[model samples]
Each structure stands twice: as structure tokens, then as C-alpha cells.
Target chain A: AQSVAQPEDQVNVAEGNPLTVKCTYSVSGNPYLFWYVQYPNRGLQFLLKYITGDNLVKGSYGFEAEFNKSQTSFHLKKPSALVSDSALYFCAVRDIRYTGGFKTIFGAGTRLFVKA
Target chain B: GAGVSQSPSNKVTEKGKDVELRCDPISGHTALYWYRQSLGQGLEFLIYFQGNSAPDKSGLPSDRFSAERTGGSVSTLTIQRTQQEDSAVYLCASSLPGSYGYTFGSGTRLTVV
Candidate 1:
């Protein structure tokens, strides 16, 4: 089974400072990883995905994630954070060959608090 | 183009009652999915519908949770004998076949009392 792990329950960063949210995955073949953000009472919004390409993938709202194959990690990053960026973030992973037919397996989620 | 839409933005029902949540996917989308979100938690995949194939219900938490898609368009999720644990935001998403990104609806908040 493909699974994702977000070791951090929450991450705090001051406004204008860089932020990093850690994520790791376990899967059988190649992995398709994704990042999503959720605001209070709102559905998840896609941030970015890694489906075999450059290690660093850029996404919406000035967000980016680095895919490290050696460590099986995909960490979300931002050069500078804003108070509005405070929300819940999730890391998901899907096996390319599992074919058990599922969308993706999401992590427990990490609460991001960007203080102003 | 309009994104995915769900009805009954908020639902409050008593225990042992039945509830139905509706989802209208983006026009022309062939893949639809249902997910559950608890307060301050990540999404839990409930079910997925792809074209005319049988839906993947492996993620459903219990037999009381069931979903169906009509004409491969609108979908409905029915929860029977709802429990307090079932109270959460039910989200719906749609995507094209083989698409990477899924457009999500605002979600229906179901509260079981």
C-alpha cells in the first residue's frame, strides 16, 4: 500500500521568513506525489505535483516542493511567508503501478501558522 | 468554467438518521471522487468514480457509507445510521481522465447530533 507521512503536526514561521513543511512517502514503484492546501471550512486546493521530472517543482501562490528520491521526501517551501499563507497543508502519494485504483493517499496534515 | 459544486452546504442531522449529499462535477469530467475531512485533519478518500467502470470503494470507512454516480455526471453520497464520528465536511472533486489536478467543491458540512 502507498502511504505518506508528515512528521510535523504544525509549523510556525514569521511573516517574510522562509518556511518548510516536511513530507515523506512509501510506495512500491515510482511515486506520484502531490501537495494541497486547505483553508478553514474550505475544500483542498491543489498546490503542485511531482510525476517524474525536475526535482524542484513550482506551484501556485509562490509555493514550491523539492522531490528527493534518495530520502523519499517532498518538502514544500516558500521563499517568504505571508500571514495569509497560514492554513493546513497535506502531502499525498500514489503508486504508479498499484492499479488498485485510488486517487491518492494523504498524510495526517500539517497546520501552518505564519505570524505577522 | 465553473468548478465542482456540492449542495446542502451545511447539514445537521440526528443520530440514526439518513443523509444524502450531492455533488455536481465539472461538465465533461470523467472522474469524480468523494472525500471526508475532519476538523483540522487531512482529506480521507471515501470513493472514486471513473467513467463507466465500477467505482473504487476501497477507502469507504464502513458499510453505512455508499455513493453512486448517475450518467457519469452528478454523484450522491448516502450515509445510513449516522454516528457522531461521521460529522465532518464531505468534499467532492472532479477531474478529466488521466488528469493530475482535481477541481474541488466547497464541501458539505454534515453534523450529526
Candidate 2:
């Protein structure tokens, strides 16, 4: 089974400072990772995805994630934070080797609070 | 549609009653997915519909939960004898073939009282 884990339930960062939201995963085969953001009263928005290439994946809103094969982690990062960046973040994983079908599993989510 | 759209942005239903949530995936999107967002369970995948193939019901919690996509465009998720635990936001998303990023709707907030 493919699963994702967001270790931090919440992360607080000051405006203009760097922010990092951690994510780890476990999959039977190669993992196709992705990040998503959800604002209050809205559905999730796609941030970025790591399909096959590039350990460092850049996403919407100046967000980027580094995929560490050894660590089985894809941590989302931003060079500078804005108060508007506050939202819930989710990490999802899809096992590319799964012959059965394509199913993406999501993490519990981490709440991001960017204080200005 | 320019984006995925879900109907009944907010829904309040009596416990034990049946409720149906609808989703209109993005036009030309070949893959549609249903997910439930709740405080306890977080975001859980309910079902996945790709083209004309059989829908994946593995994520559906129980028999009380059922969903159908008509003409490969509009989808409706039906929950019979709803429980309080079923109260949460139901989100719908769609993706093009071989596309990793999915566009999501605003979601329908279902409240069972």
C-alpha cells in the first residue's frame, strides 16, 4: 500500500521568512509524489508533482519541493512567506508500479500559519 | 466547464435520511475522483472514475455509500441512512489522461444533523 505522512500537524512561519512543510511516504514501488493546498471553504488546489525526473520540483505560488529517494520524503518549501500563504497542505503518493490501477493516497495534512 | 464544479455548496440533512452530492468535472477531463474531507478522517478517497472503465469503489467506506457518473461527465454520490460521521466536505476533482495534476471543485459541505 502507498501512504503519505505529514509529520507536522501545524507549522508557523513569519512573513518574509522561509517556510518548510515536511512530508514522508511509503510505497511498494516507485512513488509519484504531489503537493496540494486547501483554503478554508474551498477544495484543494494543485501545487506540484514529482513524476519521474527532477528531485527538486517547483510548484505554484513560488513553492518548491525536494524529493529525497533515500529518505522517502518530499518536503515543500518556499523562500519567502506571505500571510496569504496560510492554508492546509497535503502530500499524496501514487505507486507507479501498481499494476492494479492508479490510486493516489493523501496524507493527513499540515496546517500552515504565516504570521505577518 | 472552465473548472470542476460541485453543486449544493452547503447541505444540511437529517440523520438517517439519504443525501446526494453532485459534481461536474471539467470538460474533456477523462478522470474524475470523489473524496470526503472530515475532521476525523481528513481527506479520504471515495471513488475514481476513468473514462468508461468500471469505477473504483475500493475507497467507499460501506455499502451505504454509492456513486455514479452519467455520460462520463456529471457524477452523483449517494449516501443512504447518513450518519453524523458522514458530515463533512465532499470534494470532486478531474484530470486529463496522463495528467498528474487534478483540478478540483469548491466542494459540497454536507452536514447531517
Candidate 3:
């Protein structure tokens, strides 16, 4: 079974500092990795996805993710954090070889707090 | 619609009653999905539907939970005998065939008292 893990329950960072939310995944074959953001009482918004051909993928609102195949990690990163960036982050994975369907497995989620 | 649309942004029902949530996917989207989001628990996959194919109901929690997609555009998720544990936001997402990302709606906040 394909699964994704977000080791951090919450990550606190200072405004203007770099921020990173870690994610890792396990799958039988190549994995399709995605990052999503959720604001208070809002549905998830897609951040970025690593389908193929690129190790680093940039997404909406100055967010980017680095896909590390060796470590099975796709960590969400931002060069400088802002107060508005504080929200819940989720890492999801989809196995390319899965015959069932295109159902993505999401991690438990990591709450990000950027203090000003 | 420009994006996925879900009806009844908020819903409150008495326990043991039935509730239905609706979703309208983006125009031309070939796939639609239903997920549940609780306070702490992450998004839980509920069901999936593709153009005219048999929906993957594997993620449904119980027999009382059922869903139907009409004309491959609009979908309805019905939860019979709603319980307090079912109080959570139900989200709907849609994507084009083989698309890498999904566009999600604002979601319907269902509260079962």
C-alpha cells in the first residue's frame, strides 16, 4: 500500500526566516507527490506536484518542494516565511503503478506557524 | 463553473437523520472524488467516480454511506442515520483525466447533533 508521512505535527518559524515542512513516502513503484495548503475553515489548495522530470517543483504563493528520490522525501520549502504562510500543510502520494485508480494517500498533516 | 462548486456551505441535522451533500465539478472534468475532513484527522478518501466507469467505493466507511454522480457532472453523497462522529467537513474535488493536480471546492461543513 502507498502511504505518506509528515513527521512534524507542527513547525514554528520566525517571519522572514526560511521554512521547511518535511514529508516522506513509501510506494511500490514511482510515486506522484503533491503538496497542499489549508487555511482556517477552508478546503485544501494545491501547492505543487512532482510527477516526473524535475526534482524541484515550484507552486503557488512562493512555495516550492524538492523531491528527493533517494530519501523518499518531498519537503515543502519557502525562501522567506511570511505571517500569511502559516497554515496547515499536507503531503500526498499516488503510486503510478497502482491499478486500482488515481486515489492519492495523504499524510496526517503538519501545522505551520510563522511568528512575527 | 470556473472551479469546483459544493452546495450548502453549512449543514446541521439531528442525529439519526439523513443528510445529502452535493458537488459540481469543473466543466469537462472527467474525474470526481469525495473526501472527509475532521478537526484533527486528515482528509479521508470516501469515494471516486470517473466518466461512466464503475466508481471506486473502496474508501466508503459503511454501507449507510452512498453516493451517485449524475451525467458525470454533478454528484451527491448521502449519509444515512447521521451520527455525531460524522460531523465534519465533506470536500469534493475534480480533475481532468490523468491530471497531476486536483481542484477542490470550499466544502460543506456538516454538523450532526
Q: Model 2 in CAPRI terms: which quality?
A: medium
Clashing residue pairs found in predicted model 1: none
Each prediction's interface RMSD? 2.3, 2.2, 1.7
True contacts kept of 1: 0.53
**Candidates 1 and 2, the one with greater DockQ:** 2
Which regions of candidate 1 are displaced past 4 Å? A97-102
Write model 2 residue lDDT over A1-116, tens digit each, in one string: 78899999999999999999999999877788999999876789999999888899999999999999999999999999999999999999875643334567889999999998
lDDT of 2 by residue, B4-103 (tens): 9998999999999999999999999878999998974558999999898888888899999999999989999999999999999999999888777788
Docking quality category of candidate 1 according to DockQ thresholds: medium
Cα lDDT computed for each candidate against the true fold: 0.91, 0.90, 0.92
Which residue pairs clash within candidate 3? Answer: none
Let me know the DockQ for model 2.
0.60
Model 2 regions lying over 4 Å from their true place: A97-101
Error of 3 at B80 (Å): 0.3
- Sorted by lDDT (best first), the order is 3, 1, 2
Model 3 interface CAPRI class: medium
Q: Note the residue pairs that clash in candidate 2.
A: none
